[model samples]
Target: MSASHVVYVLSCADDSLYTGYTTDLERRVAEHNAGEGAKYTRGRTPVAVVHSESHESRSAALSREYEIKQLSRARKLELVGGE
Candidate 1:
């Protein structure tokens, strides 16, 4: 059995969007809220998991993360239902 790999988008406290890969979505979101996640998200705490996609492997998740990161802010928001 293997853990799930996830590509996720977060809506930050400052209304910024962040994209990242994680195996544990819930825990990662908690870490972001605690100001212990990615450096970019540290100052933008209280992040919410606005979007997420599960992949079979870490590589797939990471690749998707990269792809999402390349999207413009408007596009990213579209992925999260324009929230």
Candidate 2:
């Protein structure tokens, strides 16, 4: 079986939300916490994966990530089960 792609939401240290797609969720989260991930998340260290969804393709995961990023903060929070 092939690796699944993931769309994820992170709760940042500054109380902000971040969305991204990756095939290796654990490694990506570790990179974010280690200050080696996306530039937007670099300074927002100590991020926690508040939400995540798996997809069969990279394209699907990336599209979903974009959709999540476009949602309002309130909606995004709701998507994360209000966490």
Candidate 3:
């Protein structure tokens, strides 16, 4: 069996949002919090998992991550269960 892939949203220290896909949700979020993740998030540490959705494959997870990234802040908040 294979582990699930997930598309996740993180709330940055400045209250902005970052979206990405990963196989290990917990570890990825920890990396962001540790300032070892994406460049945009490194300066805004202490990111927390605001939302996540599991997918069947890496491709599907990436697709969803792209979709979320293209959304407006208002729409993203709606998808993440509101502000």
Candidate 4:
């Protein structure tokens, strides 16, 4: 098993962005799609996995998540192909 935390980007139903971290990426994605994920995603179902990266530690994943959150929408779009 991968001893890493996964940072994921979700494209929401409203065409918004959501970033988070999890050890089980597939399960997390499923939760989000089912509207049982993050509070922000509860109302806006995740449409797709826009981006995903793994880190050696949860701290690293969190740091990366913060950085990605700070990025402009345009740059984030560049990071993950825009729809």
- On lDDT, the leading prediction is 2
The reply for model 4, stretches above 4 Å from the true place, is 1-3
**Candidate 3 residue 56 C-alpha distance from true site, Å:** 0.5
Clashes of 2: 0
1-83: candidate 1 lDDT, tens digit per residue: 56499899998999988898888999999999898999999998889888999999888888889999888888888889994
Alpha-carbon lDDT, every model? 0.89, 0.92, 0.91, 0.89
Q: Between 3 and 4, whose lDDT is larger?
A: 3
lDDT of 1 at 41: 97
TM-score comparison, 3 vs 4, better candidate: 3
**Error in Å for residue 43 of model 2:** 1.2
| Candidate 1 lDDT | 0.89
lDDT of 2 by residue, 5-54 (tens): 99999999999999989889999999999999999999988999999999
Model 4 agreement with the true structure over 7-82: per-residue lDDT tens digits? 9999999999888899999999899889888889998975678899999888989999999999999999888888
Please, what are the lDDT tens digits per residue for candidate 3 over residues 1-83? 56499999998899899999999999998888888899999999888888999999999899999999999999999988876
Could you give me the TM-score of model 3 versus the true structure? 0.93
Task: Report the alpha-carbon TM-score of model 1 versus the true structure.
Answer: 0.92
Instruction: Single out the weakest 10-residue window by summed lDDT for candidate 2.
Output: 1-10
Question: Which pairs of residues have clashing backbones in candidate 3?
Answer: none
Model 4 residue 64 lDDT?
95
